[model samples]
Target: MRLFGYARVSTSQQSLDIQLKALKNAGVKPSRIFSDQASGRNADREGLNLLRLKVEHGDLILVKKLDRLGRDTADMVQLIKEFDQMGVAVKFLDDCISTEGTMGEMVVTILSAVAQAERRRILERTNEGRLEAKAKGVQFGRKRSVDRNKVFALKSQGLGATAIAKQLGIGRSTVYHVLNNP
Candidate 1:
């Protein structure tokens, strides 16, 4: 069975050296180590893409942390399911997370469920808070797109919509809205 490792950092400025060291300690070869310096929000990362393509049945993919695998629990769970179907094993060194056997599957599932539930609860609480604020007549969202008097002044000064947008650091659409509606 082949052993491969994947490492990632949110930005190019961050170092992958720590993860690489951990993967190497886990026995993954230097040649088989794939890395990407991109955000987890991006699904088509270079290193992750190459690893998925290169890994075969009976191959094991090692990671320093479970978060290195994907952005969220749902995303990681889906990826794990795909790897399990392909007979590729994924092992998270930090969390002892694996998708190899029945016990491993149970652990991953339980953890994923707990995470998802927590996210849902947080969302519900945030929405409730927003609703309560709205009931008290709280204004939300971006306060008026642009300064009203400024747009009028710029227009009176013979500046075009695009120019007003650039000068105020607002969108051209906002400039038009302020000019046309007023």
Candidate 2:
């Protein structure tokens, strides 16, 4: 049997060093460590995908925290179930929980449900806050980078979208958007 460690950080601004260190301290080898600098909400993380592909029966998967594996409780539960069916074991270091026994299964299920509800509530609150801001006339999307007048001027000079973008240091798509809008 082999032991593999997975570590994750929410963003590039965050560091995976702490998670990696914790995994190493748990006796996971450096070569067996997989990591991702990505949001837990994203399911297609490269590191996680690689780990999933490499794991085999009788292997043990270690994560610094349950949240490192997934943010949604349902997804986490499903993943753990899959690992169990494959004869692979999963352990969360922070929670000190494993998917290897009856007690562990009960604890994992209860915690997963609670965590899932918390995540759903957090998403609801975030959406509500965003809607309130928008209702108050706050802009939500990116501002125009190139001036409309500049785009018009370039167009009047017979410059197409590509040429205008090259001249203005803006994107060709942006030039097309402005030109097509007016």
Candidate 3:
């Protein structure tokens, strides 16, 4: 049976060195490790999907932590269940847990509950911050374009939509909207 490892960080600023070292020391080969720099909440990460696709019956899937496997508890649980059904084993290095036995299943269930609660708390805090900003009259959106005059000049030059869009380095739909709105 082949052993596969997965490592992840929420942002590009973070490094996977520590996780990689731990996985390596635990006997996972470098070629078997899949790493990604992206939010755990993102479901379509290339590395993660590749890991899932490569896993097979009798394969062992290793992760640094349960959270590294997924952001939401439901998703994590579903992933574990998928692996379980496929006769794949999932091991959490830090937790010293393996989803190959009854005890492991229980641990996973408990940890998944905690992870779900954490996700809900994070979402609540984010919503609270947004509401506070709204109350303070603070706008939350992309900055307005700096070259409005240039856009108007290009439009007045009788340039076609495509030409104006290319010259302004803006989308054709945006140029049309600006002209129509102004």
Candidate 4:
């Protein structure tokens, strides 16, 4: 069975050195390493998708941690189920468990539940923050454009809305508003 390693970092600014080193030290080959610098919340990460496509029956998919697979536990469980259905084995090195056993199943279930709950809590807090902002008369969308001296100068030069928009790097609607409002 081939051992495949997956490593992920949430942002491009971060390095994959640690995860790659850990996977290598765990006996995974360098050529078998698939790394991606994308958010865990993204489902279509390049390296992750490649690993999924490349994995075959009897292949072992190794991850440094459960969170490296996905941020949402439900998603992680679904992904694990996909691997299981494909006859591919998944192991979390840090967790020290193969997802094919009874204890592993329980752990996956509990982790998935916690991840879903955490996602729900985040949504609730975001909604509350938006509601508070609205109650305080704060604007919730893009800032409104204003008529400025530059618009007057451009208009005085016989520049049309389209020409002014092109010159100012703004929308035609913005130029029209400025011309009509001023």
Ranking by lDDT: 2, 3, 1, 4
Candidate 2 scores a C-alpha RMSD against the true structure in Å of 3.3
Candidate 1 per-residue lDDT over residues 61-128, each given as its tens digit: 99887667666666767788888999999988998888899988778777756655765787799999
| lDDT tens digits, residue span 50-134, model 2 | 8888899999999988888888766777888888888889899999999897787778878777777888898899999999999
Lowest lDDT 10-mer window, candidate 3?
143-152
Q: Answer with 1 or 4, whichever has the higher TM-score.
A: 4
- Candidate 1 ranges with C-alpha deviation above 4 Å: 112-182
CA error at residue 97 for candidate 1, angstroms: 2.3
TM per candidate comes to 0.62, 0.76, 0.71, 0.71
- Choose 2 or 3, whichever is better by TM-score: 2
> Backbone clashes in each candidate structure, one number apiece?
0, 0, 0, 0
Candidate 3 per-residue lDDT, tens place, 115-178, comes to 7789889899999999999999999999887377777898788898899889878899988788
**Which lDDT tens digits does candidate 4 get at residues 35-73?**
898877766788888898899999998888777888877
Task: Please give the CA lDDT of all the candidate structures.
Answer: 0.85, 0.87, 0.87, 0.84
Local distance difference test, candidate 1: 0.85
